[model samples]
Target: MRVLAFLDGTLADPDAAHIRVDDLGLMRGDGVFETILVTDGRPRELGPHLDRLARSAKMLDLPEPDRAAWERAVRAVLDNWSGGAELALKLVLTRGIDGDPEQRPTGFALGMEIGAAVLRGRAEGVAAITLDRGIDPGLAERAPWLLLGAKSLSYGINMAAIREAVRRGADDVVFTASDGSVLEGPTSTVILLRGRTILTPPEHIGILPGTTQAGVFRGAEKAGFATKVEPLRVDDLLTGDGLFLASSVRKLTRVRSLDGTALPAATEAHAELSAAYEAEYA
Candidate 1:
């Protein structure tokens, strides 16, 4: 079952929650969203998620989201959703109808059951492929209007890349820059294991700052692994000891292979990644 709540205090019937057809968010993808992991009735890293939401809004020039209101709506959905199983809590904020200045922005919170594939892939690992993003991230810095670092709803390209990954016989993708520098996965952050250090690309290169990776890096430190945020390239993954992906809903999932070639299996490190992901608060 799904539990949904509107910022306007609407709850119970999801069908009743609706946005206008002319809403800029639906028409032009003028919106931002966050996918959160909810274990039982508790949300993981809610503060970080909200802060990112605000940052995305500021990037889009949308009004700052009312965080307290969003938190309450999240609670209401969790209360409505009854179960001990993990759930994906999606918070969506959109620009309201065009020319309707009086109308507040459209926003809602949705709590839904996690899919079997995402949950199973966590423990079993997944296959991935690398695709060039075809744009220099340095261009992203100069072209600030591209909104590169924000988690906006303009995800048509990202979804298309995933379809390409499936066609290539892989479960996910790791996007590289135009120069073949490692960036991140479509919906996850890329991590590489080298000796006792965990390395990832810095977020300043036009990629979204991963909230899950932040906590996981901390947990990895506690688990006796040093974590570093730096620049990486395709060669690094090809020669690394192991590779993994981390996301809020997916937590941490090891990459069993990339580009159809099997990677070196690091079962022990995979377990540590899982344990570290679990150590993140709910």
Candidate 2:
């Protein structure tokens, strides 16, 4: 697949040697990022993604991103894309080369095709395993430096947890707090449906406030479905009428099984929510 990259103020080949070796984003993962799905060359929920990126940058003490610059870069990459297929536009901002007294932040945008695995998970649903995140749900408010709500580049642990789940024969992971409250997926937001009510863990639980989930909730409300933010536990998942993962790229994906136990088939609810989510970006 052809991939494009925008570095600083210029668009370049993604494989080009542009990033410095001392970049803190690569060295220490000291950065923040946002990914937006582009369909038919139009970016989905661009404003909210940029808003979240700015918030994450502030939380990380990184330099503020130039939204106009990023927008120009996104347009350049999308216009240059050869395929008519959907693309994943990722914006990355790193605290520039380490030890640089200026501490300028490195910003870039990359465009690539959405992964087949992500598409498959959306279509076929996913089997998930619950993993302890090793922290209390209230930790973010007390420990801001932990960057719980910030979408940082430091995803080693999250990726490792997913790998561990794969090793255990699961497609993905739903991270829970030390208290066993369902938090979120490693790369997605967790949502549960009971009858016509749509529920997700409250943002106070230290999970990233999901842009897509917010859109889904808005759509759900307009569609006459009750939407709420509530604490969820393992038992809640087991007993819920339906479970799903929501994100910008993955959209709304059903959870077929959790920890090897089959979940209720909420196909009708899933279809309704999926349509509602699609309308938000359409």
Each prediction's number of clashing residue pairs: 0, 0
- Model 2: per-residue Cα lDDT at residue 119: 91
Report model 1's TM-score to 2 decimal places: 0.96
Q: What is the C-alpha RMSD of each candidate to the true structure, in Å?
A: 1.4, 1.2
lDDT score, candidate 2:
0.89
lDDT of 1: 0.88
Model 1 ranges with Cα > 4 A deviation: none
lDDT of each: 0.88, 0.89
Name every residue pair that clashes in candidate 2: none
Candidate 1 lDDT, 214-234, residue by residue in tens = 988988998889999999998
TM-score to true structure, per model: 0.96, 0.97
Model 2: per-residue Cα lDDT over 28-133, one tens digit each: 9999999898888889889999999999999998878888888877777887888756888898899989999989888878887788899999899999999999
